[model samples]
Structures are given as structure tokens and as C-alpha cells.
Target: MAALSKSLLDAKKDKLPAQAAEGAHVHSSGAAQVEGDELWDKLPRTPADILRHAIKGAIRAFTLAYGARVTLAFLLRLLAVLRKKDTILGALLAAVRSQDGPRFGAFFGLFAFGWKLVSHSLREIRGIDDRWNDFVGGCVGGLAILAETPERRVSYMQQMSVRALQAIYASLHSRNLVSIPHGGAWLFALTGSQVMYAYMMRPETLPSDFYRFMVGAARVPDPILRYNCTNVRQGQVDPSIAVDLVRRYKGTADNLARAQGMSATPGVIPCAVIHPTSDSCAETNLSRWLRVFQMIAPVYASLNIVPMLTLRLKHFLTAPRTLASKAIFNTVRSSSFLASYVTIFQLCVCLHRNLHGWVERVFGRRMADSRALVFLFGFLNSAAILIEHPSRRVELGLYVLPKAVDSLFRIMVQRRLAVVIPHAEVAMFAAAMGAIMSFYQREPECMTPMMRKLMRPFFGRY
Candidate 1:
């Protein structure tokens, strides 16, 4: 009995040490976990960190924008060289050469500086922790577009305006007020600029474009000048008008044969000068409306018997889409902005044609361009614009009035001053389509040959 009691005591003593060690192990693990969490909490979320991340995002954005611009310029330059329009290593050599290389460097700087400023502002607005990954990756796109508009094309005043406007847009995107998708950023900028230019800013103080319009060849893209081909001064149409407008008018029925290829120079093509009439208002109004009408004509140009397919595709690959693409989806569903605008435009156009027919029956043919007739036509166009999109006319008004008022003001008041900004954003918007005309001029065969001819002044017909 004594031996058994001693053995039991020894067994119990050994068990206590093992149990205590297990408890100590668990405590050690818990202590280690607590310390790990404390270390994480102590890490800094400093302004320096935020700026570093913001800069990372800015650098990424600038890299993409600059790359795209440089690539485009390189391709264009290469094409020119290949076509024998330029020297063999013209752009390629210029890309490396110190003096010539500065153009691209400046081009790169525009986006880099613009985005860096935008990113720092955005970092504060979003309050996002700086991670290696930039959440707003490449959001500052379209910077290349600004660069594409050659420095020569943009005046200082216009550049200032654009910079201010672009700053607003970038800030909004950074703040997420204007989201990346659905063109919200673009919409905001467009609306804001319109308001600033029309109501807030006195456009009259701005420099004039009419003098340019009157003395220089009518800008080929001038809707009033391009469409009617009348009222625009003869020989004053930019020579590019020959390539653009097809020389619709002739000196007389007998002179049609001699009018072919009037000339390759810009603003030199013969077009009818506006016959001085009190109804110039109607003519101007009608032409402006017609320009917008043509812009939306594309959607109606084709017919699709089964439009529902677009919706099914949208439901499939759910990546981000464009305004036009979203419109396509809505179209397939039987209702969309496109459908609404198309229906309205078509109905109004038909009504105008019917009304014109009635007028022809009542009045003589010579009254076609009469003030009353032209005014009615202009009113119908205005109605179509309202019907298609309620805000469209207001947008157009905002866009044009500022310039019109400014130009008129300049002509009457600041008659001697140069263009306030050689070309304002609104002016650029109007001439956006004409910007493509540069492709023709850039093309070696089209422009380089002519340029060579001009350069070799002494060698005739070379």
C-alpha cells in the first residue's frame, strides 16, 4: 500500500509539468500575434506617402499619354518619309537630334505636368492610402489630343482657356465627381465652358474672328460658307475648299467646264459672295442648325431588321463601354437617345419639306432665298433641334453666341486687335471635322510634291 501511494504521487507530479508547458506555449503564440498587430498599427499614413502614390499614378498616366502621342507622330512622320514626302530620316533623325527633339519633349511635358498636378489634388480628395498600385490608372487619357493640335494652331489666349478648362476636368475626375465612364467628365467640361463663355464672360472683350473670316479665305469648315456655297466671298474661300466642297457653283452655266480643280491652295476656290440682304440672320441661323443635323445623320444612314442583338452582346461581355456603344445597346432594346433623336429629326425634316412645297405653290420660284422663306426654314430647323434634344440648341447657342458676340464686338470695338486667342475651344469644336484635312496635307503625295514645287521657285513644273 505504501509503494502504490508513492508511485501515484510521482505520476501526478510529472503530469503538472507537461500541462504547464502547453499553457506557456499558447501564451507565447498569443503574445506574438498581439505584437504583430501593434507593429501594423504604428505604420505611418503620412502626406509624403500620399504624394508618392499620387505621383506614381501621374507618372503612369503621363507615360501612356506621351507614348500614344509620340507613336502617332512617329507613324505620321514615317509615312511621310516612306512616300518620299520628306527626307529618308527626317522624323527619325529629328526624334534624336537636340533642337528637333524638343518638340516631343515639350509634348511630353504638357501631359506630365498636367497629370502630376491633377494627381496630387486627387490624392487629397480621395484620401486613398498610397499603395504600389495606382487605383486611377491611366484615367488622364486624351492629353494626346491637346498635343496633336500643333502649337502653331493654338494661340496663347486659347491655351490659357484650355489649360483652365482641362484643370477643372482633371480635378473632377480625380475627385470622382465626374466619373471616367459615360463621358461625365466631358459633359461637365462642355457645360462649364459653355456657361463661362456665354453668360459669365463678356465675349465682346475677346479678339475677333470675322476679320479673319472676311480678309482671309473663309475657313473651309465654316458651316455657313461650306453648305450654301453662296454668300462666301469669291477667291476668298481657302484653296482647300476645292478638295472639300466640290466647287458647287460656277461663274455661269457656260463656265462650269473651266471651274474644275479651281486650285490646290486653301481659300482660293471661287464661291459666291453673300448677296447683301437684311435677311442675313436667317441664312446664318439655318446654316448653323444644318451643321448639327449632319452630325447625327450617321445612325440613320443604315437599317437593321433585327436590332435586338446589340443588347444580348452587352449582357455578355460586361466591360466598360462608350456613349455610342451604350446607345447601340439601347437601340437594340427599341429605345435610346439615337432612336428618339432620329424619329424627331425625320418627322421635322418631312414637315419642313411639306411646308416648302406649300410655299412653292403659293409664291414664285424666285422667293426661295427670300427672308420670309429662309426664316421659316430656319425656324423649322430650330424646332428639329429642340425636338431631337432639348438642351442641344442651348448648347449650340452657348457655343456660338460667345464667339459671335465676341467676334462682332472685336470687329466693331477692338477692330485693330489680333484674335484674343487665335482659336478658341468653341472655334476648334466647330472646325473639328476640318482638322482631318491635315491628313491630306500631311500625306506626302498630296502635299510634299506641291511643297517641293514651291521650294524650287526657279524650277518651273519640276
Candidate 2:
């Protein structure tokens, strides 16, 4: 009888369902069976569900930590502004208006003076630091070349192109470029900002606010939670309600970061390796340009406002200081302030000219002859530069401000509006570029085999 009972028990145990299995039967009363079914139903949570919960929790934790820090920062700035009777923004605006005409010229003069001083100092310091001397020397050489006429500009650009090619060659041979991590803190900040923006601006597209709220309220054991949410099909969500949530949340983090004047690709290391092929080079250029635009757009958009704050602060705080110290600080600040503007101006001009020439090739019409087209192209180029210059200032302002204002304004206003507007502008610009390439430029043949070989590693994979 004992052996028979053991055999029956083993058979029953073998028939039992796995813990994660669904619809396991229980030999019990109907109520007990229903209870067992309920327990079993709770056990089969998918990994995707787990991941979703985890991501949601991570988002919350990040927002809390980041939001707190930003709030604290904004609060400090508010306090400073308040101590001045809320006149800071107005004063800054007034200062900008007053200095608009002279600021650029003033910045240039200061830059020239600094360059002279740096050059002299470096020459003197050459004995102690040869590498520094070489770098300064190279910069001086580049500047000298740039000072030449328009005809010489092409030659200078060509020379730079050659140098860039050689640098790529060296980097390829060394294999050092590929091993180095490209993006760092800036990247993290940018990624965080992107995520934040997605979440905040498009909250409806993400999971339900109630869901997030519950997770926050539940005090769940795991730091993260996973939930199985509906997926989109052709931009349509099965339950239209949930679809709206994901879209809303998709880029909320990015919007928040933008409000704070952070770059999505911050801390991206400069690319050193050059692809030997034309296709690879083009790909590399595209990637580099995208990164540059990402970094540049916000700064440019905020330029008009940034200079005002800097100038106002300088005028208000340093008015009592010695003229020499004031002048020194002003000179240093001015040059650094305008560096982005100068760089962007140069880059845009170069790109515009190149695009114009390329357009001329395909259309068989001189770009210069069409005044309207020229003006339109010129305007777009200028707009691009303008948009790329001020992002840093806004970022700096957010960083310096106190937390309370930061959180409130950033969450409610800047993240929702300011960031999205600029991004739209960037998207438009990209679309315009694509249209121009498709319609205006002639399709070229594939690069040579040797060039292909060289480019394969760097550009081909992408």
C-alpha cells in the first residue's frame, strides 16, 4: 500500500505545470480551481512587461534626481534675479539692445588682442613645451592663411582637406581612433535629455499617467517594473488610448534636456579616423554634421538672449572694479562668447558655396544669376548659423538657476515648447537638405575599389 501511494504521488507531481506555465489544473472545488487559475495567471509576466516596468521606474528615478538638481539650480538663479528685483531679464534685454552694434566688433578686437598675447607667450614658452608651441604655431598658420582673399580661401580649404585626409590615414594606421569611446558625459546628458523630452512633451504616447503614478505610489520591491503595453502598427495603436501615451512619452526626456540647454550628443569625442573612399567620407561627414547640428542648434537658438545676460551681469557687477581687471575679464569673456558665432559663420558660408556650386552643376544655370534662389539659400544658411549659436547660453542659464524655477518652468514650459520648436526647425533644415540633394545634385558613380576598401571599416557599416 505504501509503494502504491508513493507511485501515485510521483505521477501527480510529474503532471504538475511549471511555475511559469499558464492554465494549470487543480483537483479542487470550483472556487479553489478559480483561485489557482488566478495565481497562475499572475505568474506569466513576459520579459517585455518586466522591461517596461523597469524603464518606467528608471525614468522616474532619473526625473526625480535630475529634476531636483535642475530645480535647485534654477532656484539659485531666481534668488539672484529676485534680489535684483526681478529686473535681471529686462536689464539683460536692454543691455543687448544697447550693445548689439558694437559687441561683435568689440569681441573681434578682444580676440585679436588675446591672439597676440597668446602667440607671444607661446613663443616665449616654446622651450618648455614644444607640443604646445607646435599647436599654437599651427593655429597661427591657419589664421594667416584665412586672412587671404576669396581666391585663396579655396586653396586654404583644399590644404585643410589634405591635412584632414593625412590625419585620417595616420589614425587608421594606428587603430587608436576606433578604440577610443566617442561620446562621454555629454552623450549621457544628451541621451537623458532626449528621453526626458520624449516623456514630458508627448506623455500621452507613453504608458498611462495613471500607470506611472501607480508605479511611483506602489512602493514596488524592484526598482524597475515591466508592463506589457500595446505596440503600434503603422503608427496606429491597437487601443488608440495607449498609442497616444507612448508618443507623448517617447521624447519627453529630450525636451526637458533641451529646456536645460543640454546637447543630445554632448561629450562626443571628435572623429579622427578618415575613410579612404568617397562614400565612406560622405557617410562620415553626414554623421559628424548631425552631431555638430545637435550640439549647435540649441546654442544658436538662444544666442540673442545669452549675450544680454552676460553683458548685464558684467555691467552691473564689474562697474565698481578696477578698469584693468574689468577690461581683462571683458576681453576674455567676449572672445570666448563669440567663438561659436565665428565658427558657425565660417562653416555655413563654406557649405552654402559648395551647395551652390553643386546646384549649378546639375541645373546648368549659374547660382549667382538667380537672385531669388541665392537669397533664399543665403537666408537658410544664415538661419542655420543663427540657430546654432545661442544654445550654450540657455544651457548655462539653466545650470546657474535655482531648482524650484528650473523644475517648474522646465517641466511645464521649456521642455514642452522651447525644445520642440528648435527641433522642428532642425528637422526642417534636414528635410530641405535632403530635397536639395535629391533634386539639385547629380547622382555620382561608386567610388573606386581601393577607396571602397579604405572606407569600408569606417563608413560602409553605417
Candidate 3:
């Protein structure tokens, strides 16, 4: 019995240190876990992170556009199917036999490549810390559109140019040049660029043999202004473009008229009229208008998210208190802001028209022909801001004033005043924004949550 008790005591003493060590190990693991979580919470989210997340969201949303494009391309081929020329494997073989088949494949291929290029490049161009993904995007934007024919190639470049412009616009916001809501300034940079490219960008000439293969062999229809609407089915020139081309390229209307089996008499003989496919004036006009609307469709799609998100956020925040009143107020206010941007754009368009008109009347030439008129466009665009609603005008002022101040401040700080301002660049953005908002948003009710905190010192008790 005494021997058994001694053994039991020794066993209990050995167990004590093991249990203590196990408890200490558990406590240390718990502390380490808490420290890791704290470090994660404190880490500053970079602009790259925001962009990365936004892009991922955009990819999820991109299926709609990609599917639509593929569907349209497929549908356009159905006419060939109905003619009973070839079916399925036969059609595939036929396409493989010709250059047009490859051309069709190339357009979509470059388009996809261009899309990828622009997406990645945009993020890279944002700053010095650009990642490989963004570098690929920009390079893709620049080089992807290159193809066999100049006309098709230029058309592709136009799409890329618009995308580049959009990237620049979005980059401006990302750089804090503009305060577009919910960080949405970055979302549609790609889509809007695509739209603008489709509408306004055109290559002046056809690729001749290459175009012929795409249209005749491939049965792909030529876009409306391909060859400037020249090359009638009878192999004659079109009147619309012919009249201008004759004066510029072929010498004169009378010269072209006499050369093209018509009387040389200027007043009597009509200019070249090459009608293709019996397509009437109405049909041509309708086709052109449809393409124009297609360009606008993406613009609408890209921007539609903004108002939706703004109104939703407004509703969510103003919930459970005077919801009806806020709803009515936000409906008018939010929508007007959206419309104000459109209005500003429309006003610039009008300015563009008027400037062109004045240039034509005074200078006897197109506004596009003059470099001065082009420069004036930037100035006119600046003036268009004040033309918005009063509240919108105020918001614009608040937005611009800070950036303008920061511009001057940075210059001063970078020079002799560097020592006076220990860290001007670091604090300049928020301090400037707060100062401008203080003066503009005197009414505390109008302030956002962040703005409220910022303005607290300036407007005490409010």
C-alpha cells in the first residue's frame, strides 16, 4: 500500500508541468491570433486593391456584353444559311477556304485582345506601382487592333482610342481630380470607350481586295461609309461622297461628269449616283441611325449603374425617418444630377455645332479643318459646367476649387516653401477638400458623413 501511494504521488507531480506548458501554449497561440487580426485590420488598403476588386466585379458583369456581341455576329450569318449555300460543316469548310473567314475571326480575336489590353493597362497607367496585368492591358489596347487592311485596322484603332480616352478620364477621378460617387468613376471606363469608338471613329478608305473578300466571299456587309459610300453595285461612284471627292481628288464635278459618261455641263448634269442593292435613301439612313444608337447603347449601359447605386444608398441611409420625404427629394435631386451631366454634355455638343458653324461661315471651311477651333473646344467645355442647375453648379465649384488650390499649393510647397509645410502632398488633398467644402457647404444638413466630420471645426456646433 505504501509503495503504491509513492508511485501515485510521483505521477501527479510529473503531470503538473505538462499541464502548465499546454495551457501556456494555448494562451500564446490565442495572443498570436489576436495580433495577426489587429495587423490585418490596420493595414492600409491601396488604390490598386480598390481597382482590383472593381475589375473583378466588372468581369462578372461583362458576360452580358460579350454574349450580345457573339449573338449578333452569329445572327448576321443566318441570311447565308437561308440561301442554302452551305450548312454547318460545309459552311465551316467554305470559310476555311477563304480569307474572309480568317478576317472575321481576326476582328473578334483582336477585339477580345483589345478588351483585355485596355482592362489591364488602365490599372497600370494609374501609378508607378503598376502590376503585370495592367501593363498587358495597355499594350493590348495599343497593339491588338492592328490587322491586314488599313480601313478595318483604323476602325479597330478607333475603338482602342476611345478606350484610352476613357482610361484617362477614369484615372483623373482615381487621382482625385473628380469626386464621382461610390468610386464608380472607374467602372465604365472600358464600356464608354467602346461606345464612343463605334460611333465616331471611321477609316476613310476601303482595303480593296481585302474588303472585297470580307464582303463578297465572306458575305459580310460593308459598313455604311465604307469607301465613303462610293462603289455602286454597277461599279460607279456614289453621289453623296462623289460630289466631294470629285472636287478634292478628281478635279471638279464637271470633270467627273464628263469622264463618267455624262454631259460636262455643270448646271445640267447631276453628279455620280451609284445605287447598290436597290437600297433606298430611307434604308441607308435607317442603317446609319441604327449603328449610331448601337454606339449609345453602351454609354447608357455603363452609366445606368451610377444613379441606381446613388438612389439606393440615399434610401438606405435616410431609412426609418421621413423616408417618403427623402424619397421624393432624392428622386428629383439624384435624377437631376444625372440629367445635369447629360445636359452639360448636350450643351457642349451644341457648342461644338455652333463653333463648327461659325468656322464654316467665317472661314469658309470645316471646324475639323482648323486647329484653333479644336483648341476652343476645351474652353467651351469648361464654360459648360456653370450652365447646369444651381445646385449642380455649386457642387462643381466645390469639386474644382480644392483641386485648383492644391495645384497652386503643390507648386509653392515644392519650391522654397518646402520646409514650411512638412508634408504638403500627404495632407493636401483632405485639407483642401475640407476647406473648400467648408465654404461651399455652409449648411450642415447638406454635408455627407465624412464632410460633416471635416466641417465640424469650421462650422462649430453644427
> Which predicted model would earn the best lDDT?
3
Deviation from native of the Cα of residue 332 in model 1, angstroms? 13
lDDT of 3 at 229: 24
lDDT of 2: 0.32
Candidate 2 has its poorest 10 consecutive residues by lDDT at 268-277
Candidate 2, superposed: residue stretches over 4 Å from native: 1-98, 133-462
Model 1 ranges off by over 4 Å? 1-51, 63-316, 319-325, 329-380, 390-406, 409-414, 417-462
Q: Summarize candidate 2's per-residue lDDT along 319-350 as a digit string, tens digits.
A: 53554354445444433433432233334333
32-142, model 1: which lDDT tens digit per residue? 545433432332234455346445544544444344344445544655675788875677555444332344444444433333334334433443222111212112421
The TM-score leader among the candidates is 1
**Shift of residue 441 alpha carbon in model 3, Å:** 33
Error of 2 at 141 (Å): 17
Any residue pairs clashing in model 1, and if so which?
231-274, 237-267, 238-266, 238-267, 239-265, 239-266, 239-267, 239-268, 240-266
What does the lDDT come to for candidate 3? 0.36
Candidate 1's TM-score reads 0.31
Q: TM-scores for all candidates? A: 0.31, 0.17, 0.26
Clash totals for all models, in order?
9, 70, 4
